[model samples]
Target chain A: MPYIKIDVTREGVTREQKQKLIAGVTDLITEVLDKDPKLTHVVIQEIELDDWGYAGEQVSVLREKGITAKKQ
Target chain B: MPYIKIDVTREGVTREQKQKLIAGVTDLITEVLDKDPKLTHVVIQEIELDDWGYAGEQVSVLREKGITAKKQ
Candidate 1:
């Protein structure tokens, strides 16, 4: 069994987008690694700006400080 | 910076239990890996019985089939 998780900053994610991701990730795994779709678990995790940090500072704090770097 | 994710089967978990997990996981990462708590990302993912699988069967199906186990 393979467990997959997607972590993203919770700013403007829609339910439809999440659904697409769940399906896309599952299909990709099935095509690439040949894992069964039923056993291939995909989890979407949304993290708050305040809880996400980079360069020794929270994303919220960085935004406040006029820093606009994106995570890819 | 360290990112730790915990995947658990959703059943009878309490909010208080999740809070403790966040704290304990953060502490463990900080102590063991010397990571900053502020940058330490801990995401707890709860999967449904119907969404989880083991030994070529869904957890919900396994439970229905009288198979119970734990994940650690």
Candidate 2:
């Protein structure tokens, strides 16, 4: 069995979006690995900003300092 | 940055157990890949029995049929 897990920063995730991800990821795994969909598993996790850290600081902290927050 | 994800069939998971998993996995990744824990991300997903299938049947169905139900 091929198990696939996807993790994303939780900010603005909607139910419909997650549903689409589940479907798309399943299909991609099946195509790439030639694995049976019946035996494949796909899981998605939405993580809080504070729990995720980058550059030695949590994302929440980085956003507060305006280090990586902006508009183009 | 290294991202680690773990997926398991949800049965009787407890909060304390998941915390241990997060810590242990982070340590393992750091030791193996030489990545900083600050930049390492670990996510755990507990899946429902219905959503996970094996041997061409859902785990719930197998349990119902008394195929893999146990006392061993």
Candidate 3:
């Protein structure tokens, strides 16, 4: 089983959306990686923009540069 | 179910060690967080020193500074 952690901005996403994302990603992983769905484990971390920094740059900085990063 | 993902260096750790760590962490989470062990889902990510970077610095850099950061 592959464990997947998803970090996302939870501001605008609905609870249903979050659930859907988890289910969809789990399904994709099972299909693409040939793993069992029952063995799948997915973790979701909803953090504000400031919580996750990359390459010494805040996510806002990347957004300002027009570089969009998907959270998953 | 609460999903927990562990990111650790796997170089010197044995498979048994990894499994032990997962079980220990899961136990700790359950005890401290009052979560259910049966519902607990843990994922372990073993990444090379280069794949993960933080604060514009590599893990090696942090190790050099002697400010050891624990991976989870």
Candidate 4:
């Protein structure tokens, strides 16, 4: 099975949007990768702005550089 | 900060394969999405064949359909 994982910051996405994203992603994988939709697994997680860090800097600072943003 | 989570079955990928996958993915995100490699957080989780379910079917059976194969 082709195991796929997607990790995205949770700032811009809403509950409904997240659901749509998941379904769309599954469909995309099925269509392009030819994976079985029935056999594919999807997971979505919400993270706080303060908890994630990148490149020796916290996300809050990264946002100043236009490198990170809330999902919305 | 985009909290991206990836969950995949741990059948086909090796330690080196996993590391390469992670780096390749980070590069992909940076190049395609314009996200900073420093600010991005990557997570890789290994799931068992028995744990992942799709379309109401377990992955073990899904493999029989050729929908999924060990990563190789």
Candidate 5:
């Protein structure tokens, strides 16, 4: 079983977006890793700004100073 | 750096419980894996019943049928 966990900031992600993520990840795993789609589990987690940290500072504090953690 | 993610169903998990989980997991990793606690990141994610699937069915549907996923 291939279990994928995706963590993102709690920035108003919609249900449709979550569905797309699950489907896309499943497809990717099946295509690349050759995992069974039925056994693939994609879990999405949205962390609050205050809970996530970067470079020894909370994300909320970083946002206050105009610093952002980009997905790349 | 060690990043640990714990996923559980959204079933009224309290904030105090989450704090305990973080501390307990950190201590476990430090003792077992010898990882630095400062570099350890423990994230807890609670999934909706409808979002988590098991046995080819959604968790909510399984719950309606008196089936539960246990932590082991």
Candidate 6:
């Protein structure tokens, strides 16, 4: 019953990357939390820039102003 | 900060429904957990049937066998 939710910006993430993330997170939880992989659920959510907020401003607007995740 | 994630099958959820879910969940957390609505983040994830697993089988395969969520 280990449920993990990963939220990332919709920034052209590949299917392969998503698969790796799911597998890696599942393994990490199994090792650290002593959870069963079969009972673990890893959900990835790709949030739109406009929908994601930071410091009371939309990420889309921040990106337009040249403030990216890497800069932050 | 309070982060809430809601996962459901990718079954034609509308924008209005998503908005209602976000608002309702924020309000619920504020009331029950005493969390500030401004610090709350509600994410809605729509998962494909092929990606979701149940009873050691993918939901798509289970659906083909007529094992729906309602039945379980």
Give interface RMSD, per candidate.
5.9, 4.8, 13.0, 6.6, 3.7, 4.3
Can you write out model 6's per-residue Cα lDDT over A3-62, one digit (the tens) per residue?
776778998876666666776787788788888777887666678999999999999999
Question: Which parts of model 4 are misplaced by more than 4 Å?
Answer: A2-72, B62-72
Off by over 4 Å in 6: B1-6, B11-45, B49-72
List, residue by residue over B1-72, the lDDT tens digit for candidate 4.
Answer: 444455667665567765665665565555444556765666778788778786788877787777654222
Q: What is candidate 4's CAPRI-style docking category based on DockQ?
A: incorrect
How high is the lDDT of residue B64 in model 5?
86
- Which residues of candidate 5, in runs, are more than 4 Å off? A70-72, B1-6, B11-45, B49-72
Indicate whether candidate 1 or candidate 3 has the larger TM-score. 1
Off by over 4 Å in 3: A54-72, B1-72
Model 5 misses residue B35 by how many Å?
A: 21
TM-score-wise, the better of 4 and 6 is 6
DockQ of every predicted complex? 0.09, 0.13, 0.03, 0.22, 0.14, 0.12
TM-score of candidate 3 relative to the true fold: 0.40
RMSD (CA, angstroms), candidate 2: 8.6
Which candidate do you rate higher for TM-score, 3 or 6?
Answer: 6
| TM-score list, all predictions | 0.53, 0.51, 0.40, 0.51, 0.55, 0.57
Ranking by DockQ: 4, 5, 2, 6, 1, 3
Model 4: lDDT equals 0.59
User: CAPRI band of model 2?
Assistant: incorrect
* lDDT (tens digit, per residue) of candidate 4 on A1-72: 444556665466567765665665555445433455765666766565566666677666676677644222
lDDT winner between candidates 3 and 6: 6
Q: Looking at model 6 chain A, which ten-residue stretch has the lowest summed lDDT?
A: A14-23
Residue A35's lDDT in candidate 6: 81
- Give one digit per residue, the lDDT tens place, for model 2 in A1-72: 988777777878899998899899889988998889899888887776555545344565566787653456
Prediction RMSDs, each to the true structure: 8.7, 8.6, 18.3, 6.3, 6.7, 7.0
Alpha-carbon error at A71 in model 2, in Å?
A: 13
Worst 10 residues of 4 chain A by lDDT: A26-35
Best by lDDT: 5
Clashes of 3: 1
Q: Scored by Cα lDDT, where does model 1 land? A: 0.76
What DockQ does candidate 4 score? 0.22
What lDDT score is found at residue A34 in candidate 6? 86
